[model samples]
Target: MKILHASAEYFPYIKMGGLADMLASLTKEQSKTEEVYVALPLIGKLGKSPHWTGKEFPALLPQDDKIDSLVVSVLKASRFLEAEESGLKLYFFQSDLFQTLDSIYGHKEEHFRFAMFSYACYALSQILKVDVFHAHDWHTALSLALQKDSALPIPTVFTIHNLAYQGDHPFWMTGFLKEEPFRLITSPFDHDGKCNYMKAGILSANQITTVSPGYREETLSEPNGFGLSYCLRQRTLDYSGILNGIDTEEWNPKIDKRIFQTYSFLDWKEGKLKNKRELFQEMGRPSLPLDAPLVGLIGRLTYQKGFPTFLQTFTERRHLPHRYVVLGSGDPEMEDAFFQLSETLPEVFYFYKGYNESLAHKIEAASDFFLMPSLFEPCGLNQMYSHTYGSIPIVSRVGGLRDTVEESNLLKFKTGIVFEPNDTSSLGYALERAKDLFQSQEREIVVKNIMNLDWSWKKRKLEYDLVYTKAIELKI
Candidate 1:
């Protein structure tokens, strides 16, 4: 079987978050039995990769000979330096429109950048030999909608990595669809004078799936739905949720070169102390007590991850003994909060602005507990990565965080701590629990349990295979 996986950013080349890592890992696993090709927008320099074969072709986006179209470069090759990378081909879309963008996101002309990339995906799909098409997030959601509107017989699967980012734009921008008679082609994209790319994918794709089973159900529920709950609810029969897996090679504590030292669960106690001591020295806090629990929080400092709660809790409960080491940069307000806290109390707080790949690895390896109080997570990889490194996660009971991490409340052999609500108190309570547990013998057992669980791509690949088969069956 031939399958095409289209995403905006893939790992090793460029990655903003979990989407790139998840897609890169899945495509590699899927390549074993099927003919898989990954298509991405080449926003970098044209000559950055000599590994790719120049497959630049002149093709009209909609396959219409009368319309004026742009000639784009399509680099076909395998991803560089991936050990398990099978015979999968990487299709990079190189065009002036996409290359000139300030970044992958947050540009003045964000809509047009993705619109052109989506059109380029349509052109590439028509040229490639694909039996099934899989599009990730709102970035490639338009690709599924375009193929569906053209009455393309090929089955398409649209995966929602996050429902929050819908690629919304002014409805007037969709004037190109004025003459289109198909409501399925136009109505889904129309959201009260707005173009909702994700809604279009939900309404048009053969099947829709989210990153986690719990998130799939939440998307059908209230606030978590992010305004497209009704559209997702309508397509209940075709939608599903599969928990995403982490790239074990990147997160493995035994072999990760980024960490201060490599160690497994057997030696986790000593391993953690050594790394924690190293971390304290590196952060310029050599005198900080190693006995006090270190709670590491990483990822974008946004409201989505309950960023405000952490700051508020730290402010109100300044007497709490545990140390907070935060490694991430997002939202100007949140950044200020972290910086202010560190300045006010250098011993209790340590903040680092911007992403440091090596520091992230070290934090997971060293910290006593990993804090990720996300308001709504599709499926977080950090929690999974923390579990692998023997760093218990203190996550809110929502979406994949609820699905993957079992709490001490109901289960006996639980993995991590879980709080019910998204407020400051709830997050504070969970952290308190994590701090107390560190003094108990049960903490060792929980870390062991978390590491024992399998989060490999091989296991998740089978579930995707089932979904792909179901999509093909629906097409028939």
Candidate 2:
């Protein structure tokens, strides 16, 4: 099948979150058997590469109440890093509007920017005769709506990474679609008389998907859906969930060169010890005891990640026996709070302001336990990464966290610790449990079991292939 995946962010070129990582891995997996292409907006300053090629086309766009157009260029390039090895073709929509943008998102005219990019992606899909149009999140949900507005019998699939971030704008912004034949389509949902990009995708697409089955169930119910439960309920038959996969080749412990030491499950214990000591030394700390639990946290320091609950746990339960290492940058107040806490509790706490790919690998390799106490997780990649790197995840029971990490029960094989979100006591208990597990023999078994489990795109991509075929069968 000729599949065209449309998303706002793609790894290597631009990445704001796991959406980029998942799309990159998914498309690469799909391209192994089928013809796969990716469409992404050329955001920020992208350097010209020797492997890249380009073509220009005029695209009509809605500017306010006026009919305006612009000439956009679609640059075709092989997947970055892999560079044609994966057989995935990436088409970057280049426009004057995107050229000056300093970042991939957070612009005042975000709706207008993505609308133009979406139309350009739709045009590219048509030119390439794509069999299916797959749009990711609200960033490119507009592409699915554009496909519907054209009445172009193209099968479309929309994947919701996070329902919380629907691109909603005032009804007046509908002026972008004011002209005849370009008017907005009526969605199954009405967002307070506003234009909601996510709702349009859910309404128009042939199939809709969330990152995990637990998350899909959450979306079809109240609160978790963030006001779109009714709309999702309307299309329950066509809605489904597929767990996102990690890049096994990039995240594997044995072959990874970024860490201080590398080992497979055979020598994971020794490898982890070496990595741990080196990591501590590098971070300006003495080597902690071998049995001491070194907990690692990586990602955006935001409320959604349960930073508030985590902060409360740290402040109230200072007697807990564990060392904490965090690496991320987000939400200024949370960052400041974490920094201050680390300063006050220097011996047991350490926080890094920004992300470093190599440091992330080292932390994962060295830490005895990885922490992700998320308020909600659509589909978390860190838990999977932690599993692969021999780090047991201590994640909350939400979304993909619950789906991916099985609780450590003595009767059955387990992967990691699971606790309730938003409860300081629950998190404190889970951390204590992790500390206990770290010193027990079961820790070895759990780490080995999780490491052996498959979270790669190899098997999961087949589920997507089924979804695409189903979409084509029920083509709208």
Candidate 3:
């Protein structure tokens, strides 16, 4: 089978979140069994890459009169930039709008940008004659919407990495759409009658999928659905949740070059200690006690991640016997709060205000406990990375965090610490539990069990294969 994955970002080229990582791993694994292709918008960085074959496929797009005042009957011909990575064929659509983009997202014309890109992807899919078209997140959701009523019978799958962002655009953007689809879009695109790309994909695609089973359940209700619960219920029979898997090759502790030392379950204790010491030195901190648990977190420091709640917990429990380290930047208020806390309590807290790929790997390997007190998680990869590195994950009992981490309460299946979301007291109690576990002999057992667990895409890709096959069957 030939499958085409369309998204706004791809790893090693452009990345803003887990969507890139998931696509990179999923396509690489799928390529081993079937032909695979990935389509992305040609951002400034990707266009400048040496491997970029300026090979172009020129196609005309209908223009929105409100947005495209400079253009005439049809917009200027957009070029599809062709390239190849590993065994996958890559197609990057570039237009005047994309020529100046230095980043993958955060543009004022986000809706217009992705609408053109989605059209380019659909045009390329027909040209390539791909059997399955998989669209990721709101960025590529419009592609599925475009293909919903096309004469070409290609099967389409829409994967929702997060439903919170729905690409809500003004209805005037309908000028970009061909008359048939605009007429066919009778489904609910909620929120003050705006055209919602995420809802469009959910209502139009042959199949709808989220990252985890627990997240699927959460999104079917009022709170987690983010106001699309009724629309999701309309397609409940075709919706599914496949838990995401990580790329083991890039994340394996036994051979990772990013960490200070490489080790497996056999010698993890010594390896982690060395990594922890080196990390402390790198951060310019004094040596910590050997038995003290080193807690680490890496990702956007936002309300969704529950960092403010964590700050409250730490403020109230400053004497807790644990050291904390965080590497990420977001929400200016949260960043400043964490920075101030680190300054006020340097002995217990350390904050590195930005993301570093190498430092993230080191943190996963060095820390005795990985902390993710997320109020809601679609499918967190860092926790899985922590499990692979033998770092116990202390997570909230919500979404994928609940699904992936086995609570220490279950002695036989103990892997990490679990607590309630947004509850500072619960987080404090969980941190105390982690400290006790670090001092106990069972720490070794928990680490050993977590390392032995399988969270690789090799097994998880089979589930996707089934979803693709079912999509094709339904299309026929």
Candidate 4:
């Protein structure tokens, strides 16, 4: 089947969060079975790369008479040998819309920028004559809107990576939509008297999917749904969940050259120790006993990640004997708080101000446990990476964290631990248990169990292939 996947950003080109990782891995995996192509904005920051096949397609602009229409150039990129070997086509749209160094969202003309992208996606699909258009998040949500108005006979599948980030803007922002081409399209994009781009996609698409089974359930409720619960419930028959998978080849600690040491599931202890020592030296922590438990966290320093709960657990429950190394940047207040905690407890806590991909790998390999106490995680990739590196994950019991990390992985012979979301006391208790396990000889067994968990894309890819087949069958 010929599939066109559309997103705002993609890996090796641009990455903001797990969405990029998911798209890159899914495309590479699905390419083995079907013809997969991608459409993304050609942001100037990605600069120029050899992977893109620079070509242009037609785009219509209603207002400007002299240049009422222009050619939207595409930069086809597929750097991964596996994608090329499997015959996947990765296409990027090079337009002035993504040229600015400004943030992806919260721009003055974001409504028009994303709308243009969505319209361009529909145009590209028609030009390429694709069988199905698979779009991610609200950035490409308007593509379904374009398809609804057009006479195009293509089917669409929309994936909601995060329901919280619905593209809701004032309707008046889209002044150009008053023209002939956009007049026939119903304004279902307006939800609660506002332009809800995500709602429009969810309402219009033939199929809708989220990242994890737990998240699928959460999004159907009041708290986690972000006001789209009722809408999602109405489309229950059309919606489903598929857990996100990791690219084991890229994340495997055994072969990863980014970390200080390399080790597999069988011989993880030695490499883990090497990593821990390196982490201590790099973070400027004094040399401590190898038996000391090291808990690592890598994420945005935001309230959504349960940073406050983490701080409370670490500060109030001083009885627990453990060290924490945090790497992230967000919300200046939270960053400063973490920095202060590191200063107050120099021996037990370490903080890295910003994100560094290689350092993330090092932290995963070096730490005895990975902590992701998110209030609601759509589907965390770091926890999966932690399991692969033999670093047991201690996460809040919510969303994908609940689905991926099980009790067996957290028990005496288990790989990881889970606590109730936003419960500081529970988090502290879980940490104590993990620390106690480490002090005992049971830590090795736990690490071994975690290392044995399968996080490969092979199985998830099969599921995606099935989804693609079902999408095509429904289209037929």
Whole-model Cα lDDT of every candidate shown, in order:
0.78, 0.81, 0.83, 0.78
- Tens-digit lDDT track of model 4 for 202-294: 987878889998999999998999898999999887788889999877799878989998998778888988888887888787475567888
* Top lDDT prediction, candidate number: 3
Error of 4 at 379 (Å): 1.2
Better of 1 and 2 by lDDT: 2
Q: Which stretches in model 4 have alpha-carbon errors above 4 Å?
A: 47-50, 59-87, 178-180, 184-186, 286-289, 408-413
Model 1 stretches astray by more than 4 angstroms: 45-50, 57-62, 69-87, 177-184
What C-alpha RMSD separates each model from the true structure? Answer: 3.6, 3.7, 2.9, 3.9
Q: Mind giving the per-residue lDDT tens digits that candidate 1 earns over 1-476? A: 88988888787665777898899888877777888887777665332353645455432443354443221222122111111234678776666656665357666766656665665566566677578889888888877777786656568899999898998888776544333222235664787568888888888788889999999999997798888899999889989899999878888998999988899889988889999999999999999998988999999887888878767777777677889899998899899989998898898999999987789999999898998878888899999998999988888888999998887565778888888656888777877787789889998898888877788888788888888888888963
- lDDT by residue (1-476, candidate 2, tens digit) is 99988898777677668887899888888888899988777665543341454444334332312433222222121112112325877776666568677568778788777776776677667667789999998878877877876745578999999999998887676565544324565444359788888887898899999899999998888789899999999999999989999999889999999999999999999999999899888888774555678899999887889998998897787786788999998899999998997788778888899867789899999998999989999989999999999899999999999999987445378888899999999999988888788878888888888889899898788898888889999877
Which residue pairs in model 4 clash with each other? 409-415, 409-416, 410-416
- What is the clash tally of candidate 1? 0
Candidate 3 residue-wise lDDT, 1-476, digit = tens: 99999998788678777888899899999998899988887777652363666677643423322344332222345667788787878887777777778887778878777877776777678778899999998888877866876777589999999888889877776544534222245335555678788887888789889999999999999799998888889888889899999988989999999999999999999999999999888888856655678899899887888988888898788787888899999899999988987898777788999877889999999999999989999989999999999999999999988889877554687878899999999999998898788889988988999999999898779988888988998962
Off by over 4 Å in 2: 46-50, 54-85, 186-189, 287-291, 408-411
Q: With candidate 4 superimposed using the best TM-score fit, by how many Å does residue 308's alpha carbon deviate from the native?
A: 1.1
lDDT of residue 65 for candidate 3? 27
